[model samples]
Target: MDINYLLIHHDELLTYLREHDYAETYVNRYKTTIKQITDNASNHNWTTYEDVYQWYVDQSYSPTYLHEVRAIIGKLEQFHLHGNFPDNKKSYSSFWKIKSAYTKLSSEYKQLYEDFETQTCKGLKSSTVASYRTKISSFLYELQCKGATSLSDVTEKDVLTCFFADGVRKRSGSLCANIIRFFKILSESGNEEATRILAYIPNLRIARKNIDYLTDGEAAKIRQVLEDSNYSLSCKDRAVGRLLLHTGLRGIDIACMQLEFIDWNNDRIRIVQQKTSQPLEIPLLPVVGNAIYDYCINERPMSASPYLFLDSRAPHNNLTTDGIGYSVKKIMSAANIRQEKGRRKGTHIFRHHLAIKLLSNGVPQPVITRTMGHTAPESLSSYLHADMKHLRECALSVEDFPMAKEVFQSCLK
Candidate 1:
């Protein structure tokens, strides 16, 4: 029960004690405690009974005194009930969320990000870092969706939903494979509970699929419109789009970028990609560098922090993956691109386009894997590796035979 009820009850009980010849000093102590509780009770706040009782118990109240105090607290509870206060008014969800938010971050995320930056990214070639990044990012993206900024409340469902299957019925068996690796890392970092919950997750391996690449003309069309889009889009937004398209950098890598990391002198740039903790240095082409320079000089606001990207609003924190997607969609709509990939064209498709461009340019499979950060050198070979019109040409080859070849040569002519 609330403390105000107890305070009012104490007053009447004190008067009865005075009638029984109790000394003024004894009655005054109870009066002071009651007054303090009453002031705190105006907002219905109560120190938990266990906390209060533990303190009172240490003061060594005799058996009779304990019984009397219990009776008085009971009277207070009854008074609270009669006065219209109810116990279940607050939502536990909000309380738990607040508690989790205030809780400290786990050592695991810090270690993984650090390790990725120092060991994985630095020692590895430019491309292998990208694979490490994808593995980590897809996992973190799941955490962000669940509103789990802290480690304590993270459970198996949060892990599975974030890293598991893409919700298609066809790949039902492959959902649990990567989560095993992720949970092992967490458990090794001393999160036993997260580990325990993770054990029940199943084991399944799924084959990877090919990627669809956009043609140069098609890419140019999208680029022109993305720049001209009417969302009053910031130079930073357009630049981010261009960077993704040109370099195939992941969203989190972009998010964690800093000004000092740019190596303008040598035309190479370094990034400690957030997911893999790798320090990847890409040879920044003039186009990509100019786009980034424009954003840094013209768009980015001055701040105490060094993150290359910041929110447009005050108290700006880091932008989440969804925020990045929302911007991409806004620009894509203005570009008049179809809005059909799960209700949106993904920013990650830029990576696919990059892969295709490398293939079409006759860039080797190992080179694509290295530049894109694939652990398995052959991983990216499954990409369309050929443009759409070329694929059509190849498919019609068996059907139209000599005529199709002449048609293809005539087109090149």
Candidate 2:
């Protein structure tokens, strides 16, 4: 803790701090605290948290400053012990812990759940896997509460009750689908009870609701907002907004974009769509291209991270999907674009807007399908509901159905 020793070792400490992307203010504070400790500590060789804390207390430092100094001492001690700073930021959610129902399950059911989880992890995104696990856990917990300790003991009535409990009938479609998948997994594991329960559960047919898309005026307003020099929006915001509006890239795609993905020479951007894992090549329109260029050149932080978009703050981590969605919503609000009730108001609205634009321009369904990365041709059918102009074109004349008049007269008589 000698001042001379810290001065000599300043380069090493600075390097460690910088490597962790510690903010400038934090780094300066640490340096100041280390200098004070070096100058004042009776012994210049404290190697443990207790020794350091005692030294600070002996100095009669205030409680807050004592806490701060202790934190620095802890970091230094960790470095001496491990040869590297411990990642204090390392954390994860407890939601992913094994469900309580697992302990009550029969050995066979326990193994079945484990296998199902493993398979889901392999085929689905982490978020989707977590959702499936939650739903399955809830169902299992419900069954256990109903006095069914094993999968074999679960009756069709129990399954129905669990699916319909607590006003679940209104939201039963997705729950029904999840239950169906659970039963399928169990049936695959050779559980005859699961197959029997599956046979008795009727499919809940859910209607597809029309998605909200920006009208031409709203789209124009958004573009104008992005291009406005006096607007308070940051360069990153403008870049993300233009990319979503022009290319219809999903939020995850924009968040995960890399510098290497841009083919500047060809004026195209290539991305592996995160949701579908499909490779997409979108033309780099000049306006959108300029916005990205302005952001990268002007506002993007200087970091070695490969991602094109990053959090502007220190640590400079890649942007998340939620972050991008929030940016889009902010821009929408600034542009005075009101979100309708029950309509999704996120970056995805831009995608829907792009699809509607393509459809309005008379782009063929096959082309739209490819552009939107839809696996099925029929997936574009919902957009038809919004294309009233095209529907009018397809309207048949009443004169063309002369037999309809005679049928009406006969019915009246």
TM-score of each: 0.50, 0.71
Candidate 2 on 1-413: residue-level lDDT in tens?
Answer: 23355557766877777787778788887778667766656545664446666777887889998766666766665554454553443222222236455566656666767887875568567777777767777777777788887777878788777757675663357867886888788788787888887886769876566666678898899989998987789899999999999988888899999999999999999988787677888899999899999999999999899999988666778898877987887897788776656656788778888888898898988888888877678877877788867888989997876786679899899
* Global CA lDDT computed for model 2: 0.77
Against the reference, the lDDT scores of all candidates come to 0.61, 0.77
lDDT of 2 at 160: 75
For candidate 1, what is the TM-score?
Answer: 0.50
Q: Which regions in candidate 1 have their CA more than 4 angstroms from the true location?
A: 1-171, 178-218, 226-231, 340-343, 382-413
Residue 384 accuracy (lDDT) in model 1 = 56
Q: How many pairs collide in each candidate, listed in order?
A: 11, 1
